[model samples]
Target: MSDAAAYACDNVSTPVEAVQAVLARDDLTPAQKQEIAQGFSARGLEFDVSEQVCVDQG
Candidate 1:
């Protein structure tokens, strides 16, 4: 597995948490973030934007 995939697997138990963790990272570019978001959608993993915002604020 790639380092990013390994990191995601290590950190998150679900797809939404994976996206949240990716969003929280300062290292990724916008394209990379978009790729992650697209990957989530392809997998049919849905998440609420408001919930993500609450997670960020918490």
Candidate 2:
């Protein structure tokens, strides 16, 4: 694995943070954003969507 991946794998227990980081970036497509949002919703956590819970940068 790449160094970054290796380090994250060893350190970050919650991969959702990394996924959310990617989602926040403008590089992700709308479909990707939707998928991430849905996945987060499915986790049964109370999400403050207006608080930029995941893909929302605005």
Candidate 3:
């Protein structure tokens, strides 16, 4: 999935929300999840549930 799509899936939600959404589905594999997480992290897009801000926001 594209970053925009991932963001869309995770829109207005937390990293946990994105992770959960990715986890709940069967389409992506564990490697895919890790890849997604890594991609987000590398781009500084991790989510904060409490703050409602992407890591890049700071």
Candidate with top TM-score is 1
Candidate 1 lDDT score at position 47 = 36
lDDT of 3 by residue, 1-58 (tens): 9999888777645665666576556687656766766665634456222212347755
> What is the descending TM-score order?
1, 2, 3
Q: What pairs collide in candidate 2?
A: none
lDDT per prediction?
Answer: 0.62, 0.60, 0.58
Question: Total clashes, candidate 1?
Answer: 0
TM-score of 3: 0.35
Compare the candidates by lDDT and give the number of the best one: 1
Instruction: Kindly list the per-residue Cα lDDT of model 1 for residues 1-58, writing each as its tens digit.
Output: 9999889776556756667887667787766766666666644355332223235555
- The order of the candidates by lDDT, greatest first, is 1, 2, 3
TM-score of 1: 0.44
Candidate 1: which stretches are off by over 4 Å? 1-13, 43-58
lDDT per residue for candidate 2 within 17-57, as digits (tens), equals 66567567777777777777667653433222223446767
Inter-residue clash pairs, candidate 1: none
Cα error, candidate 2, residue 16 (Å): 3.0
Residue 4 accuracy (lDDT) in model 3: 93
